[model samples]
Target: MTDRRVQKTKKAIREAYLSLILEKETPKITITEIAQRADIDRKTFYLHYDSIEDIIHEFGRQETEALILHLEQNDFFDDTADMAALFRALNALIEANLELYQHIARTPSYAFLWGQIKDILKVSLTETMGERLDIPRAQLEICAEFYASGTISTYLAWLRGDLPMSDDQLAEIVGDIAYYGLHKLISPPKAEGDEG
Candidate 1:
């Protein structure tokens, strides 16, 4: 019974927070406001959360976990280099939580989201090593770190409107770049009216 109650309270708090976020910025919210919105007392809020940020952090964790599961099921783990599913899942996630993304990106907790993605990629890529990478452990670590950073940076750029591409297009472009190198996405421009 206690477990169920705890789940209910946590769910209530998260739901309230989402509703409030849709109407106002996260900075302007408080425990009292969330309690009122959730129809719970301050004590109930504290019972399940240390602060609004705690709940938000947990929410981000839960969201990233879901994304990872989705990615794995789609065979993102088939190979260390199979990042297309990961990118697709990421695109869907950002689109689904655009408002929350805008809010969380403004807070210190924003790093947690990217951090989670990096960790997930590291683990998934590590798993894809059938018999361990032939490179030195330190070297492989560096490469994985670079790839994960590049993946996260691309999504961040998409969020910031650095490119006119849609999320799917961006994902595909990123996949091409990661798998086929820069030449896949860009070739030298031909003279006007030039044909292949």
Candidate 2:
């Protein structure tokens, strides 16, 4: 009975947090507002979180985890895949919690949220590139950092209105770059011996 009550109380708190965010910017909302919305007192709120920021982090963490799982559910890790769907996964995340993220991105906890994103991408990339990439330790770390930053930065660009492209289009474009690599940037000199 105690466990069930705790679960119910936590659920109420989470749902109330979402409610408040959807209703207004996260800043305008306060612990009092959330506690009231949860139909609980300030004591209960404190029992669950050290601060409002802690609850906010919990919310973003849940969102990032859900995005990762949804990607796995759709078999986004299929062998020979280009990992384009990962971008789509990100898009789905933004769309799923559009209001919340829009607000959180403006908060001081934005860096923590980004850290979660990087961790998720690191796990997924390692799974996808396993064995196929016998990269050196240095190169492996560099590859993960480059592609993870590229993905996040590209998504941020889309969010900030750099491109009018939809999530799918953005995903395809980014995926192509990942799959084709920077080789296309080089020019080939035509030679007599090069003719097949």
TM-score per prediction, in order, is 0.81, 0.80
lDDT of candidate 2 over 1-196, digit per residue (tens): 9999988988899889877776776678799999999999999999988887787678768877888787877778775365677777787878976666655555454667777887788667766775478878677667777788787777766765677987788888887677667564455778877865
Best by TM-score: 1
lDDT of 1 by residue, 7-27 (tens): 988999999988887687668
Candidate 2 TM-score, C-alpha based: 0.80
Candidate 2: C-alpha lDDT: 0.76
What is the RMSD of candidate 2?
3.7
In candidate 2, how many Å is residue 88 off?
Answer: 2.0
Model 1's TM-score against the true structure = 0.81
